[model samples]
Target: MAVYRIGEILRMKREALGISREKLCEMSGEICSPQTLYRIECGKVKVKRETYQQLMSCMGQLPERSYASIIVPKNQYLSIKSDIYDHLVFGEFEKAEEKLLLLEQMMDRSYPRNRQYLMKYKATLAYKLNKIDAEEYQRILVEALRCTIPQWDEIDMAEWPYNEQEMEIIFDILHTYHALNLDEKYLDACLKLKMNIERHYMDDDYYVTWKNTVHAIISWIISNRHQYEQSIEYCENGIEQLKKYRIVGNVNRLVYDIFWCTRQKYIESNLPEKEQAPCNRQLAQAYYLSVAQNLQSQSEFIRKKVKQFDIKELFFL
Candidate 1:
């Protein structure tokens, strides 16, 4: 079966050399059609050794002296890595991590700095594990960032292929750092990267998604510092942008976070009844599970002190 597949690779190589199926049939004096060529390429049909040689001769190109010249019976190293990456994108973090560990063992450490794809994968795995020993994770991030920047710069912006999957992996790292709240510099770097992505890849959907994410993170940071007005401004700008671009997936999450922040602001300001009520209702509904778990504490402390509003009436409204 494997030998048959090897013959198929040879057929594809011939076709790629610009040798038409009809031309190959004429040169080799063998009956062949485009459908026959496809079947061979797909490994559903086998060819005799002499037929394979004749086919190669017709194309005036032959496999060279390289590992890829001879097809391996089993999957190649990169193929397995590709499969693992697919699993990672689909949220199979555990299975992806297991395969990544195996891949690390097989890696040639002498070429440690080579293979940008592998480095990116390692960075992504570290992010998934939430391995937050800063020095370690940042080391991986730095390498991945270095690789990504150069690639991003060289491509023609007009025709560049946006790797959404890779972008998502990097976003995971950024979101992780945001969660830890320990690496402001790294987070800033992430925001700069997000801006670069938006500037150059506006046509790509990821641009909007990442932009909203960064906006949401920035709003959170500002809100934590008690910069309520600035926080609301950032969140409102982000929400407006998301709406403008019709990016709905993360908009709701951002809205929920923004509402919570707004509620906090109202409580801090001791805002008037009419103004605080809406924000309170929004926070309560968005964070119902948290509020439920701490209902007594919330009523005694948060609800009581946030005296401008009535939770019961707000919920009814």
Candidate 2:
């Protein structure tokens, strides 16, 4: 059903412009009928992609663009794009490719932005298939990044066409960069990912998970660079945030990350080898705690071991 608010907005805009129904139809090149416009204004029928495009143009709302031929209808495009996204995420390359071909056919080749998004998906597929070398993949990423989210500060993802799906895809590319150990790219990607997550905070499970994942990745990167203290801090903050949000996803991994960072710093501390055993014991206890919390059957036994070894005191220490 047509939303009444949309009808009201259309009526108000049309009246404010002092454009009669006949003049509006004339202005719209008569692509939509006057009766259809009346139905839209009365909320009798739902507004369609073409009708909305034309009506908005008549009201000087939609800017003129050369991508006019790329009309696959909004709903169909969204459905197909969603299917493609699902297939790509789940490693269903052949299915994703099939749908991608249809999506590409629906796009305007004249539009550079269209090709940039396609290149991102293509680069992602190529990377997954091991067809492109890491350098080539990174180059493709650089190229795609040029066009995606240009002027990130000036633009709002929510206001973008397609609800910023392209921007989300760019985040996937950043994740791949992190996975590849492309340290040079981490600073930019992490900063942007942080900003993106902050701006689009949905207060939902997925957002929480992704935010924690990014923090964990950043922690891992920082630790590899021998910044153990910062790594521990990031891990601690992430674990606490997850707990505060009541997110039960395996936070043990992050706690173990802290343990690993602590172990690294201990190795660098130059303490007597005998004295290091206490720290090693604490590290082992941390690992055991992670395993116990992760597995129900092991939790009871690990709890007993923790008490036997006085590991609970290690927590306070």
For all candidates, the clash counts are 0, 0
List, residue by residue over 56-158, the lDDT tens digit for candidate 1: 5565433221222112235566576677867875678888878877766666544323344567677666666775454566566556544433443333322
Find the candidate with the highest lDDT and give its number.
2
Clashing pairs in 2: none
Index of the highest-TM-score prediction: 1
Q: For candidate 2, lDDT tens digit of each residue in 82-180?
A: 787788756798898888888988887565567776887788778788888766886776676555334433433333231233445556666767667
Error (Å) of candidate 2 at residue 174 is 2.7
Cα deviation of 279, candidate 2, in Å: 7.1
Candidate 1 to native Cα RMSD, angstroms: 13.4
The segments of candidate 1 whose C-alpha lies over 4 angstroms from its true place after superposition are: 1-93, 99-117, 124-132, 148-187, 198-200, 272-275, 284-317
Give the Cα lDDT of each candidate. 0.57, 0.65
Pairs of colliding residues, candidate 1:
none
**At residue 271, what lDDT does model 1 achieve?**
88
